[model samples]
Target: MTAVKVIKVVGTSEESWEAAAKEAVERASQSVEGVHGVEIDHWTAEIEDDEIVEYRATTEIAFPVQD
Candidate 1:
């Protein structure tokens, strides 16, 4: 039998939504092993001086269960 695990993580970047998503995956991979997939749940941004300052991404990271 095969098993998997998923966890939610939030990443932020001043660049773009894609960068934010990439940050989430990259940062998560640092601590979580066997990281294989990622799904973006939602996107948000911060405004400053009536302009977009930061991009945020909520993602679900998936990896195989370990025993």
Candidate 2:
């Protein structure tokens, strides 16, 4: 049998929401191994002076557990 665990994380970027989502996984993978999949939970943005300044993404990362 295999064991899997999930973690919630947030990533922000000045580019796009897709990039933010990808960044979340990329940053998480730096500390987490055996990453299998990612689930995008939510998306939001920050606006400043009638312009969108930042993009944010919330994601859940799934990875395998080693015994």
Candidate 3:
């Protein structure tokens, strides 16, 4: 039998939302093995001086459970 797990992780970057999302998956993989996929839930940005300073992404990461 096989099982999977899903977890929510937030990533931030000075670049774009895409980069933030990718960072979430990559960071998760560093700690949890068998990282399979990521689903972006939403995007947000930080503004400073009326300028976008940072991009944030809320993502769901999926991985297979290890025995």
Clashes of each: 0, 0, 0
Q: Candidate 1 lDDT, tens digit per residue, 1-67?
A: 8698999999999999999999999999999999999999999999999998999999999999999
User: How many pairs of residues collide in model 2?
Assistant: 0
How would you encode candidate 3's per-residue C-alpha lDDT over 26-66 as one tens digit per residue? 89988999998888999999999999899999999999998
Consecutive 10-residue window with the lowest summed lDDT within model 2: 58-67
lDDT (0-100) at residue 55 of candidate 1?
Answer: 97
lDDT order of candidates, top first: 1, 2, 3
Per-model CA lDDT versus the true structure: 0.96, 0.95, 0.93
Q: Give the root-mean-square deviation of each candidate in angstroms.
A: 0.7, 0.7, 0.9
Model 3 collision count? 0
Query: What TM-score does each of the candidates earn?
Result: 0.95, 0.94, 0.93
Best by lDDT: 1
lDDT of 2 by residue, 1-67 (tens): 8899999999999999999999999999999998989999999999999998999999999999978
Q: Rank the candidates by TM-score, best first.
A: 1, 2, 3
Runs of candidate 3 exceeding 4 Å displacement: none
Question: Where does candidate 1 stray beyond 4 Å?
Answer: none
Q: Model 2 off-target regions past 4 Å?
A: none
